[model samples]
Target: MARALLPLALVGAFLLVAPPFLDLGWQNALINILIASLFALAFNLLAGQAGLLSFGHAAYFGVGAFAALHLMARIEDGLGFPTPLLPLAGAAAGLLIGLVAGFFATMRSGVYFALVTLAIAELFHSLAPHWQGVFGGEAGLSSMRMPWGGLIFGSLIEVYYLTLAWVALSILLLWGLTRTPFGRLALALRDNEQRVRFLGYNAHVTKVIIFAISAMFSGVAGALQAISNETANYVLFASGVSAQVVLYTFVGGATIFFGPAVGAVIFTLFAYLVSDLTRSWLLYQGLIFVLVMLYAPNGLGGLIHQHLRHRGQLDWPRLARPYAQATLGSLLVASAAIFLIETLAVVFSRDYAVARRDAGGGFPTYEVFGLDWTPLSPVPWLLPLALFTAGLWLVLQARHPIGALWQRVRAGSEPGVNPS
Candidate 1:
C-alpha cells in the first residue's frame, strides 16, 4: 500500500494540474481518455469479474448518453436541476435497461450470451435513427450544458475537471467493489457457475446483478462523453464501440483491476497523437492489438504484474541484458513494419496512381516520411528487410537467456532451494 501511494498521488496530481497547461487539442484528448478509461473499467467489471463477455455493452453506454441528453434538454427548458447531477439520468437508464437485457442474455452462457448482447446493441443502433422523438432521429440528440453555481462549462477545462472527478470517483467505487463479499462471489461465478449454484447462490441473478452494475457505470462513462461532446448519436451504439472496449480490456490485461484503463489511455493517446500523422492509423492500432494478444496473452498489465510479483526473488542484474536485447529487438521489428506499411500506403495511394498514369504508367518517385523513393529501386526496400532480419536474430538470441533467467528465478524462489 505504501509503495502504491506515491505513484497514485503523482498520477492524480498530474491529472488535476496538467490540463490547464496543455493545448486545447491535448486537453480535449485528456477528456476522451478519462471517459474511455471509465468505459473500459466498467466493461471489465462484467468481463473480468463475472467472466461474462458482453459484445453489446455499448447499448448501455449509448442509452446513458441519450438519457443524459434528454435530461439536459429538460434542464434547458427551465427544469432547475443542477447541471453536474445530469449523469444520474444516464445511470438510472443504464441500470434499468441492463436489468431487462441481462435477464434474457444471462439465460445462455459463453458464445450465446455474447451474441445476445451483440444483438441487443444492434437493435439499439437500428432503432435509434428512426426513433426521432427520443433519439432525435438520425441526427441524434443535442443539448447545452447550462450554467450552474457560477461555473459555466463552455470551456474544455471545465469539462475536463468534471470528467476527471466523475471518472476518478467511479473508478474508486469500482475498485472498492472488489473488496466486498459479492466481489468474491463474482470471481466464484467466473470460475464455475455450477459450483456457485451448488454453494446456494442463484447464478442467473448473480450474473444479472453484475451485468446491471457494469452497465450502470458504463452509462456514467457515456454520460460523461455526452457532456463533453454536448451531443449523442446512434453511432454510440455501433458494434465498433463495443469492440473497442473489448480490445481495450483484453489488451490491457482484464485480470488486473486497472488493466483496462491502462489500455484505454494508451490507445486513446495513440489515436490522438498518431491518427493525424497517417491514414493507416487504424491498421497500426489493429496490428498493435494483435501483437500484444499474441506475445502477452494476459495483456501488457500482466507483464508488469508478473515483474512486480517476482521482484524480490528475480535477479534483475542477470535479467537486464536479455530484457534490453528483447526490447531493442522488438523496437527494430516494429520500426521495420512501420516503414514497410507506410511505404506501401503511400505507394498504393490514389495520388500515387494518378502520378503513375501521368508518367505514362511507370512507377514514380513518392515521398514517405519526407524522403523520396521510387518503387522500382531496391535500396529503400532493403532497409525494412535488414531491420527485420537483425530484429529476428536479436530476439532469437535473447530468448535463451531470458528463459534461463526466469528458470533461475523460479528455482530460487522455492523453499529451501540453493543457487550457486
Candidate 2:
C-alpha cells in the first residue's frame, strides 16, 4: 500500500507544481504529455508484460475517441451526464472492440500476431474516411462540452486537472495489475509460452484478457484527447499514431512498469524542443531511436537498471578512462553524422533550389553552425567525413578496453570472485 501511495504522492506533487510554471500553450502541451503517457503505458502493458508486439493499437484509441464524440453529441441532445465521465464511453468502446479483435489476434503469436493487429487497424483506418455517418468522413466529428454541475470544462486548467486525475488513476490501475497473479503469469508467458502451457495455464485466454485491458486504457487516452481538443479526426486512426506509441514504449524501456511513461515524457518534450528549431525533427528522432537500439536495447530505464544492479561491482577508477574514451568517441561520431546528414538534406531540398533561383545562383552556399561552405566545395564534405572516420577508428580502438572492463565488472558481480 505504501509502495503504491508513493506514485500517487509524486503525481500529486507534480500536479501542484507544474501548472504554475507553464503558460497556456505549455499547459496544453502538458495535456498531450498525459494522453501520450497513458497510450504508451497501455501499449507497454501488452508488449512489455505479455511479450505481445502490437502494430495497430491506435485502432482502439481511434474507436474510443469516435465513441466518446458520439456520446457527447447525444448528451448535447438531452442525454444528461457529467462531462468528466466521458472517458467511460471510450473505455467501453475500446473494451468491446478489443474483445472482438483480441479473440482472433491472440490466437497467433510472434510476427503473425503483429501482422494481424496491423491488418485490423488498417481496415478501420480505411473505413473511417469512407464511413461518413459515424466517422464523419474526412472532417470527422465535433462536439461542444456542456457544463456539468459547478465544474465548467470551459477553461484549459480545468481540463488539465481532469486529465491529470484520469492519468493518475490509469497509472495506478495498470501498476496494480502488474502485482497481481495474472501479471506474474503474463511475465511467465513472455519468457516461455510452452512452459506456461505445460504448467496448465491457458496462454491464449491470458493474452486476450491482457490485450483487452490494454485497449481499454488506450481508449480512455483517446477519449481524453477528444475532450481536450473538442474534436476527433481520421488522423486518430493513422498508422503513424500506432507507430509513435510503439516507439515511445520501446525507447522508454518496456520491461520497466513506468518505462513507457518516462519515454513518452522525454519524447514529447524532445519533439517539442526540436520541432521549434528544425524542420528535420523526424531525422533527429530516427537518429535517437537508432542510437538507443544499438547501445541500449533495454532503453533509458534498462540502462539505469543495469547500472543500479551492478553498482557494487563497478570499479569506477579502473573503468573511468575507457568509459570516457568510448563516450567521447561515440559523441564525435554522432556529431559528424548529424552534420553530414543535415547538410545533405539542406542541399537537396526544394527550399535550397528556391533560394538559389531567388539569388540568381551559380551554386548554393550553406551556412551551418557559423560555417559558410558551398556543396560544390570539397572542404565542407571532407571535414565531416574525416571527423567521422577518426571517430569510428577511436571507437574501434576503445572497444577492447571497454569490453575487458565490462567482463571484469561482470566477474566481480558473481559470488566468490576477487577483484584483485
Candidate 3:
C-alpha cells in the first residue's frame, strides 16, 4: 500500500503543475479522470473490501451532485450552505439516506441486497424529473460560483484544481479507513457473515457502516462533479451511471489499493480519444473493456504490480524508458487520428452546402487559425489522412521493440538486477 501511495503522491504533485502546461481539452480530461477515480474508490469500499455488490450506487452519487447543485443555486436564494464546502452537506445527506436504506436492505444479503439498492436508484431516477422544485425538472439545476475567500471558480482549470483537492482529501480518508480495526472487522464480515455473528459481532451494523461510508465518498465525488460541470440532471441517477461505476472499478482491478485510479485515467483517456475519432465511440469503449476483462482480471495497474512482484524488487527508474516509449506512441497515433477525422468532417460537411447556397446564412462560418473558409478543400484533408495512417503504422512498429526489450529486461537478463 505504501508502494502504491508513492506513485499517487507523485502524480498529485504533477497535477498541481499540470494546469499551466495544458489547454482546456486536457484539463477537462483530468477532471473526468478525477471524478471517475473517486466514484470507483467509493464503489470499491462496498464491493471490493466489504463483499457487498451494489447495482445502484449512483443513487448516492446523483443525490450528492444534485444536492450540491441545488445548494449552489439556492445560496443566493437563502436555502442551503455556501458552495465551497457544499460537499460536506451533500455527504451528510447521502450518509443519512444510506443509513436508512442500508438498515432495510442489509436484512437480506447477496442478490436481495443488490435488488434493494437498484430499486432505490430507480425510485430516485423517477422522482428527479418530476420534482421540479428540487431537481429542476428537464432543465436541471445550473450553478454559478458563490463567494468563497475571494476565489471564484469561473474557469475550467480552477474547477480542475478544486476537484483535485477534493479527490486527494477523499482518497486519504478512505485509505486511512482501510487501515483501522473497523475496516478489518468489515473484512471479516465479508468473509463470513454467520461466523461474524456467532462471534458476537453485529454483522448488519457492520454492513450498514460500510454502506454509509461508501455513500459518503460517493456524495463527495458527485459534489465535485456538479461543481466541475455546473449542471445536475436526472440522468445522473440513471442505472447507466451506476453500471459505469461498477465497470470502472471492476476493470481497474478492485483488489489493489490504487488500481481504480489507474483504471480511471486509462478509461477517461480512451473515451476522449475514441469520441474524437468515430461517431460510434461507445462501440470502441465496449471492445476495449471486453479485451481488458478477458486478458487482465486484475486490471492494468494490477498487471504492473504482478510483474514488479515477479522481479522481487520494484524500481520506478527501470519503468521510465518503456513506459515513455509506449505512452509517446499511443499519444502520437491518437492525436493524428483525431486531427484527420475532425478535418474530414469539416471538408465534407452538409453545412458547407448550406453556406454555399446563401453566403449570409444564419449558420456560422467554419474557421481554423485565421482562415474562414466556406469549406475545407480535399487536398488539405488528404495530407492529414495520409499522415494519420503513417503515424498508426509507426506507433505499432515502435511498440514491438519496446515490448520485447521490456520483457527481456523483466526476465532477468538485464544488468542492475537487484535480487533483493
Q: Which candidate is the best by lDDT?
A: 1
Query: Tens-digit lDDT track for model 3 on 1-420?
Result: 798568768887898987769989989988989989998998899988899999999999988888888778777677546556878866987898889888888887899999999999999999989999988987789987676666777888778878888888999999898999988887888888889899998888899989999998899898888888888899999998998887787778888777777777777888888676556466556755776788678887788777756554444466566567556755665655555555556645786667656866444457543565433345446655666666666667656665665565565645777433
Full-model lDDT for every candidate: 0.93, 0.89, 0.79
The TM-scores of all predictions, comma-separated, are 0.98, 0.91, 0.74
Q: Lowest summed-lDDT stretch of 10 residues in model 1?
A: 411-420
lDDT, candidate 1, at 108? 97
Instruction: Choose 2 or 3, whichever is better by TM-score.
Output: 2
Model 3: which ten-residue window has the lowest total lDDT?
A: 368-377
The alpha-carbon deviation from the true structure for residue 120 of candidate 3, after best TM-score superposition, in angstroms, is 1.2
Candidates 2 and 3: which is better by lDDT? 2
Decide which is better by TM-score, 1 or 3. Answer: 1
lDDT of 1: 0.93
Instruction: Give per-residue CA lDDT, model 1, range 1-420, as digits (tens).
Output: 877577779989999988899999999999999999999999999999899999999999999999999999999999999988888888999999999999999999999999999999999999999998989989999999999999888998998998898999999999999989999999999999989999999999999999999999999999999999999889999999999999899889999998898899889999999999999999998998999998898998888888888888787888899889988998999999999999999888899999999999999899888998989999779999999999988999999999987888777878898754
**Candidate 3 lDDT score at position 104:** 83
Candidate 3 clashes between residue pairs 3 or more apart in a chain or in different chains: none
Per-residue lDDT over 1-420 for candidate 2, one digit per residue giving the tens place of the 0 to 100 score: 685467758877987688967888889888999999999999999999999999999999999899899999998998988889999999999999999999999999999999999999999999988999999999999998888989888989988988988988998899999999999999999999999999998889999999999999999999999999989988898899999998898888998887898789888988877788777888888778878888889988777767766777777787787777777878888888878877877888998889889879767687777778888888878988888888888788888987887788887777899856
